[model samples]
Target: MKAIQIATYNKNIIRALLGLKTVEKSAGSPGDDEVLVKMHAAPCNPSDIAFIQGTYNIVKSLPAVPGFEGAGTVVETGKNTGHLLGKKVSAFVQRDTDGTWAEFFVVHRDDLIVLKDEMDPDQAACFTVNPFTAYGLMEIALLRESKAVVQNAAGGQVAAFVRLMAAENGMEVINIVRKKESVDVLRQAGARHVLYENDEDFEQQLRGLCAELQATTAFDAVGGPLAGTIFNSLVPDAELVIYGGLSGKPVENLDVMGPIFQNKIISGFNLIDWKNELDAEDFEKISGFLQDKFIGGTYKTKIQGSTTLDKIVKGLRGYIANMSAGKILIRP
Candidate 1:
């Protein structure tokens, strides 16, 4: 089987791309609780980029396959996972073994989400990460009974799904984006409240909107001063949920008095952590709900383009250049 192999980790993205090579690899068999999936389509997500650069939370050894999630048909099932045979599934792998970037991937049965017959393969390719991240963030907001929420990196897919889920639950979203065009794009997508972070009066607008909407929950993906701004601007007792570090900086300019005097709180969100807290029954219930939304076309990941395994280096560069444009799929 052919797989995209990275022999070394490079913080410089260009060097990382230069290091990617497609090589013939021996396909490994599954164990008792595992299944072998014939890869259909995998996506280049931000997490994959970070993983390749050795900056992500979970890093495998050198010469590892980089994909974290994908969708495919289970061709070979282990003794304990026979029920998944011949099923179309969306799966994610966080193990040190080879990943979904190859023609064949072996993953534990617990990591698989059985896809609906109506779900598109391209969408399923991106199924595990962003959607679940958004779901977990919204669960925090809903648990707090928040009427509205604010999120930076609102142009990303997870933020897009958050907006849709908020609307469905009768909550509002105050979206913050860096570019003026994204403000327009989100508005055209029916986002009621969008803010351009570079605007001169951006802080003023965010503060006023937070008060008006009584938004106490903030999802912060880009750290740095922006996280502080959102943290300080929210109503008292608000919760700031930090998920991603896209800005590559620490949180700054935070008002110490808010946490000291007000009941404000800062927390971190991890998709795996959230998923672990749920039992099998609850996990299945939530997964079914989310999949139904996709089947109904209520949730969709924008797809910019696709490439074969041989052309992944070039395709991934395109994706890194314009991630907000959409995702780039790798078909094996």
Candidate 2:
């Protein structure tokens, strides 16, 4: 089988270690509660980059495949999971086994999300990550009865989903982006409150928006000073949820007084943890709801391009260069 293999971790240059190799891998009958999938498309996410650099939360042995999520057809299913055989599915895997970057993937049945027939293979390739993450974040916002929310990395796919979901529920979004051009891009996308963090008055603008909307919740993907900035700007009793550390820095300049006197809180959101917190039935319900949105064209991941396994390294380099533009999918 042809797979994208990372021979070693390269923090400095990802392409230095990434390559396509033909290996003797068996897609044998899956074990109990597992299924074998013939992968169609897999995406290159920032987490994939982190994994290649050996900085992600989940790490596999050397010379391993690097993708975590993808869409494929179920070729075989284990006992009690035969219902999934021949079904089109989007899978998320974190086991020691090779991942979705290969032509074949073996994952536990629980990690697969059954895709609606109308869902395109490319969109389904990205189904398990950003969409669920946005759903989870909005779940928190809805639970808090927040009228509006703030989020960094406004140009990313998850942020785009968050904005759309918030709008559907009559909630506002204060989007913060590092690049000035992103402000215009998001605004044209119908975002009402987009802020350029590089601007001189970014802090003042954020504070005003948070107060005016009474936005008590914020989702932070870029940590470091931006996390603290968002944390301090929200109204009293607000919660700042940190999910990704794209900035590669720790949260800084957080005002202790807010937590000590103003009822402010800092938290984290992990998609795996969020999913695990729900019962199987509830998870299935949410999955159905999200899939309907995709099938209806209410939600979609922006796709920049697609690549073959042989060109994965080149594709990844392009993706890392302009990440906010769109996703790069690997057609394995």
Candidate 3:
């Protein structure tokens, strides 16, 4: 088997190297509760970079194989889990152990989600984090039909998912991006309104759009000064859900009057916390919803780039660039 490992921890310092010879090791030789999978594709998400930089909530020991979600085919299974053999599946794994970056990995049979045959491996690899995060945000916020929502980093995969899901639910989406070129990209992806953060009249335009669209809920991933701006532009009694801090900085302070006088609320969300509360049945239900969306062409994953295990450095660097409007995949 082959895998990629971080030689060191530094965001500007690209430390991943490829073609490292390794042996796949599993616990208890695949017990009845486990299955061995030959990983086909895995997406490189922002969390993966944070893991390497030791900034993520879940830190990994050095020389770690770092990937969170991936899709693969079950090649071997314990007697009690034999039913899953030969099935294509996707999963989220523990952080410290050998992850989807390797050619082979093992996950509990219960954790191995059977994906629909029509779902492509690349799409399945990119599925869990962005889609589930978008769903959880909407669920926690108690969004209503016909109400409008706002999202920052609208060019990101998760933001794209939120826009599409909101549209399907009969809600309007006001997407905020930093580049003018992203306007068309997001609009084509179903964003009802697109605003550029770097525009000279950004705040004024956002207020006008919010007033015109009646947008009250804001989903902000780039939490910094941008978050404070988004919070201020909300209608009275609206909510702001902060999910990611891509700015690598803290959210700016806002005047106390907004929340006290306007009756607005601010909340933070973590996908792992939400997943811990769901049982297998609930998980399957969410998976079914995602599967249906995929089948109906309501959900789509853009591929920024794809590479084999040997080209991991290039892949990692590409992800670090943070300009691609899609997920990067690695085949191991």
Candidate 4:
């Protein structure tokens, strides 16, 4: 099978070599509890870039295929996993392995989440990461009775998911975006409040927005100087969850006095960590939320582009350029 590999990892000039014609390498026949899937589509996420650069938490061995989450059809299954054969499923696999970027991959039957036939393949490809992260952040930080929450990079797919989820829960969202145009994008997607990060009075405006919304929690994706600004705008005893560092800079120092004196809480989240900590019952609960949203037509994926496996490098470059509003997919 032809696939893409991280040909070189130069911090200054990272390169991916596409059209690597090669035979499929099988790890092993599916265990009794595992299923083999023929991958249909997988998204190129920021984490994929981090993996290639070796800056991500999970380091990849050189010449590895890289992708985090994806959806596919079951081709075969172990005896105990036989019920899953021919079903559509999504998975989160270990990095550097033959990930979703390949023609085929295997996952534990328990780890695979079944998807409905009505769901789009591209949307299903993205089901595991962004949506689940948004859902978990809200579940962990926002109490049911909380009025509102704030988030950075509000225009992103995950943030958009958060905004809609909040609205459905009867909670307001104060979504902050670096670009003015994103304000419109998020507002159309159900954000109750929007702030422009580039505004000269961004700090003042953010505080005013939080005050008006009475926001008690903030989800920060852009972790650099922007994180400090987000920290400053929280209500007393509010919680802030930092999950991404798209800014490529260290998170700014917060005024320690505010958190300590105001009794605010600061923490971080990594979806992989959260998933690892959850038992089967918890996974079912979270998966149920996503499933319900899909049935209700509340969870929609905006596909930026789709291409064949041979064009993987081009897809990665497109994502790196930030040229897509939604996800860039590779169909195998």
- Among these predictions, the greatest lDDT belongs to 1
Off by over 4 Å in 4: 13-28
Candidate 4 lDDT by residue in tens digits, 65-130: 677788999998998988898999888876445567788877876567898777777778888888
Task: Give the whole-model CA lDDT for all candidates, comma-separated.
Answer: 0.93, 0.89, 0.78, 0.77
For model 4 the TM-score comes to: 0.90
The candidate, 1 or 3, that scores higher on lDDT is 1
TM-scores for every candidate against the unseen true structure? 0.98, 0.96, 0.90, 0.90
Model 2 spans > 4 angstroms off: 15-24
Q: Per-residue lDDT of 77-109 in model 3, one digit per residue for the tens?
A: 987998899999998876456667888777776
Residue 60 of model 1 has an lDDT of 94
Question: In terms of TM-score, which candidate is stronger, 2 or 3?
Answer: 2
From the highest lDDT down, the ranking of the candidates is: 1, 2, 3, 4
Total backbone collisions for each predicted model: 0, 0, 0, 0
Q: Positional deviation of 16 in candidate 2, in angstroms?
A: 5.6
Residues 52-150 of candidate 2 have per-residue lDDT tens digits of 777789989887877899999999888878899999999998887788988988889889998889998899999999999999999999999999999
Q: Give the least accurate 10-residue stretch of model 2, judged by summed lDDT.
A: 13-22
